[model samples]
Target: MTAAVSSAALPALLGPHCTVDPDRLRRYEIPERGEPGKASGLVVPQTEAEVASLLATCSKNGVKLVISAGRTGLVEAQRPDGEVVLSLEKLDQPLSFATPDGEVFRFGERAAPAAHADALAAWWRGIGAPPCEDAVLEVQAGMAVDAVNLLLAPLNLMWPMEMGSSSAASVGGCIANASAGANAVCYGTAAHLAIQAFGYSGDGREVLSDAPAWKAVPEDLLAINSAQPRPEWGLIGTQGVLGVITRAKIRAYAIPGQREAALIPVSDMPAAMRIHAAARALFGDDVEEFEFIGKPALELVRDLKGDAFRSPLARHDAPYYLLLQVKSHKAHIDLAGMLYEFLADAVSLPEDQIGYAPLKALKEIRHSITEASNARMRALGGGRLSFDTATPVAVFGDYLKVLEAELKAEYPDMALIAFGHAGVGGAHLHILGSKDAPVARHAKALVKIVFDVTQDFGGTFSAEHGVGTKWGDEFIARAPAEVRAALIAAKRRHDPAGTLSPRSFALDRQLAG
Candidate 1:
């Protein structure tokens, strides 16, 4: 039998919409982490007022709550254990647009000269009408990223950020994870794209909107929550433990007219770094996306994809390959020509060896690598362990060497599959461990090695992926005391009951009676 909610008053307050039936609640039990847990009940609120009321009622009734959105999180942040599962699914709504009045929202920092030129030209050809200046998109918490992009297409604007799971990722969940997409090198992360975040405090004390650099609280509270060097509004990445992110105002960018993609094979990381520098100099901000896939990863994709999958490096025996995309707002800018010219000077591959593919086709190869790896892992009856850690751009090559050396020494049989934004020094590595090995033991040992090495090099253990229930221990162990204290204080102020996603960020310690 499933555990029951602490408050019978919840059902009375939320009406028939709140469900305690086991059949309906069973589905909420398994979150993205695929953990075993039970939800006492499920609540799906439609309006911001309803959300605020639900949270207020939960606090008043002494009930725990876990916010669920898109259900795409990998860290088990939404795992519910005899708590009320608050689903944002019904909060989905059509996006609204408004011209910034200079207070509610503001235009993002002016793009560099290169990006400025690109944006202006794209704005001029605006679906037969002039683009509106200071246009901003107001998105609800539950709208999927792909749906949001579709809505913006009429204005020739897009969310700019590109993630592998955009098809199912929600705007709120992306902010909650501080997710970075493929184009993050130029477009930035969700935290940067979001200009305003509006949500109810977990304890229902306040219904507020936290915008960039806007601290509408007492100086004392700001000193506690915003004390850390990291931006405080980015608390959206805290997984709604502090509060439920109901809506966000995002800064949109114009879609580029001229876009081109190419695959280049390099002999080593040093060579890749040289190419990276050359591309930045040539394209400036026009270099929208740069992805790197080691030879091992490329081979894995090719093997799984079969005859239909062709490699861009068919003739080259290089150890690394880059999938690069260049987008320009100017119609006269020949992106393909630029790619060819850069190649002539940087790596100097023969003309016949050039593998010029369309932007969409090249992206397919990049995304397919992860898909193929997952398929292979399933076939072998073993799970894949992934690490998201980014080192300084200059020392990324050294970091890679250390990672490879440690992996080889410890687990020679495991396959090392890594692909990510090489320009930003973020590598998403998937290791396929032995099917016979114990999953718990392997995961613990491997995670320790990765975190320890990452810290030694001054790299973050959790990069784009936020630490959830799984990494709470690691976060507590590694985070500086002052930083942790600031976060806890913020949690206490926003979620006095420790009712929303309790135990996240080690906030559970404050909840002990």
Candidate 2:
């Protein structure tokens, strides 16, 4: 399966700086595996033409290819199994904003953390509204998510998606994984922000993009491109099955005013639900985020670290805590009392109700605790476990209880963290544990248990983080048969020779089922 593509052929395939090194491929493929040993040889192309040429060659010779972006991918999607790797790392091109007089006020730079800040430099050029009439931000696919945000944030603007691994994860990686962050409560996932992408087909012939013959198709692929295939069960349906994302047009703008936040303690799950109900009744539009965390999740954050982890409860009786956020604190009454008092008074009424509150200074306490605890968590150990699912906001009440029962049965002694946009019915449920646990079989088993329970309630198996090679075959088979069929069809349309990434979409034993 390993072929030695001649060194002279590579010069025509990539930019001046690009190379094809066996060692580099080894590095890119290592991290994604359970043991960092699954990666294969490398092919780093510096330009889109080179990328296209590489794919064309793969097609002609029947070579399997896996694309690597920022290298922060959690799954083994990019873990090449003796296949050629089409690296879009050389696509780090910079974009900018300015006057026609050549008075360049600013520019959007596309470089890794090691490079200079570019996009934010341009963000400051025009924060009110961008000029240049339909000026598209054509960021090079190799840029990392955090670098993009830092570039925009100085001007109070931000890139579309945010992942916990943003600093190390690349823009293309975010698109491939359909990354989401805390703000996904208001803004959507990467899939929503990704407007267009410049990709190549394995056939050596260009197939699609907004500008191609299939111009009728929207760049966002919102309605699904008949010419292209979508992923069956998770986001980034195109990561492996389709071609690599070399360039993308994304929505970028100013970050809202200092986003206001609060951390409040709830007596029970119902108490947390009550707060969610009253908030929806009040600032339905302004409320940007609503997150919930159980005592066990917090207890783990505290146990691994210390007392700094945010906790509203001194006593273990409450069982959970609620973290709510607003764009502005324009609520008329005392914020805490407004939500809690209403819950304790009127809102609680069976299936029509949510958890109520004893929250006196909910907002202030929540912010203070988060600010205090997050620091401790950083000092200790653990990345945000950040697993999430969403159902109809109406059915979320019923779903949460079922989700809890499922977790208790499967993940006892493990810390489970749940929070994020309850108003939208999407919740982030992460399993807090030692990094050591991430490599353990027990932890891997729980991911399935959590997904099974979440799926039975009619929730999508994945909300933001796309399924990569990390999860097992059962997870992919769990999806509906029609969906899988469509996904495979999409894969074939783009990567017909099965020479792209085999790991991105698993079509092994569960193929027929």
Best by TM-score: 1
Residue 414's lDDT within candidate 1 is: 74
| Cα lDDT tens digits for candidate 2, 1-513 | 335444445434434544456566457657532455433346677677777777777676655667777666655666666655566666765454333344443343434533445444444454554433223355667877776676555545567464345666777666655555555555555655555666666655554444211111121122221112354322243554566767666665545543544455566665566667677667665566666666655554565445434334444445666666655434354554554454446544232223332233343333233333344345435443445466555556567777777777765645565654455556666554454444144755676677677666656555554555554363466656676677677666767776666655465323334
Backbone atom clashes (below 3 Å) for every candidate:
0, 23
lDDT for position 500 in model 2 = 67
Give the whole-model CA lDDT for all candidates, comma-separated.
0.71, 0.54
- For residue 356, what is the lDDT in candidate 2? 32
Question: Model 1: per-residue lDDT, tens digit, 1-513?
Answer: 122244455577566679888888887787754556787788998788888888887776678887788877776777786778899987665445654453222223423323333443354454335554356777778878887776667567788768778877889888766677787767667766787778888867555445443221221121111112242663465667778888887776788888887888877765776777788878877888888888888877778878888655556466788887888887887778878887875668777556787666778788888788777777766677877777666666677778878987997777788788777777888888657753345888888888788777667776776666667777778877877777777777887877788856556754462
Off by over 4 Å in 2: 1-23, 97-136, 204-237, 304-317, 328-390, 407-448, 508-513
